[model samples]
Target: MKPLLLLDVDGVLNPMSRPTPDFHRYRCTVGAEVYTVHLNPRHGRRLIDLALATGSELVWATTWEEHANEWIAPRIGLPSLPVIPMRPGEPSEHGEMFKTRHVADYVGGRPFVWFDDQVWAEDEEYLRVHQGLADFLLIHVDPGRGLTSRHLGMAHEWLTLTGFSQGS
Candidate 1:
């Protein structure tokens, strides 16, 4: 099976920092809440290239859930991707981030690479113990910086080492 590329919206794609020339500010309304997100349009192409090289499928694992496809994807030039159902503000039993349990369940035994600003040491240990032999990489993106070429490079390196490359 192809590996999964899990993406988080708030910190991984839409940075909280001030916008750069390459980043565009978009005002999105989800229900009654309006969110202003800074997105780099080029990130879409970069992510798609990474997935193609690694033979991975991009999946959304964020609080935005279905709204990511509606708001974030189009702004960044990405096609609709599958979203991992998220229960915002719900606490995890393992004391890790709220998304940890849900992410574990969603990937099953498939290898995956997850990019999120909230990833902690506890989450890594929990997944290491629970995921068994399934290889996984958790990239901690700084919310101030968002996704960068370095982050993409790290993912590519990991996928290649794990034999998840398209040429594998």
Candidate 2:
């Protein structure tokens, strides 16, 4: 199966603290209701380049769903990307569990790389239990810095472990 690279919006890509560092958030009107929206990789070209280079498919594993591409992608100089909405009926749990479970569902027997700062307690346990998900990588980033070469190295390690790396 082709590998899915699952990315989170708020803390992983955009970040809660930055105004669109790698990611960003804002309030906007959607239809009749006002909603807080987020944008990521304010500079997404490099990220997009990296993903394409790695032969990994990108999926928005965030609460933003389709909005991620709609409100966010253009600013970053890229087109829309596929989205993986949060778990249905899961209620608002911590960001990590929500991401973990949802990503597990999103990948659905495929391999994936999960990039987010919120991969909490349940995430570790779930990863521990599901060894086949070993092909799955849980990449954590500091909300302040976004994805860095260090994080990319981790991703590279994971990709290598899973035999997905295209070596130089």
Q: Which number leads on lDDT?
A: 1
lDDT of 2 by residue, 1-168 (tens): 557777776666565554533344567665687766455443477666656666777778887788777766676666788888675567544333755666665677776777888776668677656545646677877877666667766765677676775542
Predict model 2's lDDT versus the native: 0.66
My TM-score estimates for the predictions, one after another, are: 0.95, 0.75
Residue 27 local lDDT, model 1: 92
After superposing candidate 1 on the true structure, give the runs of residues whose Cα lies further than 4 Å from its correct spot: 131-133
Q: Top model by TM-score, which number? A: 1
lDDT of 1 at 76: 92
Query: After TM-score superposition, what is the CA distance of residue 126 in candidate 2 from its true location, in Å?
Result: 1.4
User: How many residue pairs clash in each candidate at the backbone level?
Assistant: 0, 7
TM-score of 1: 0.95
Off by over 4 Å in 2: 18-27, 31-42, 88-96, 130-134, 166-168
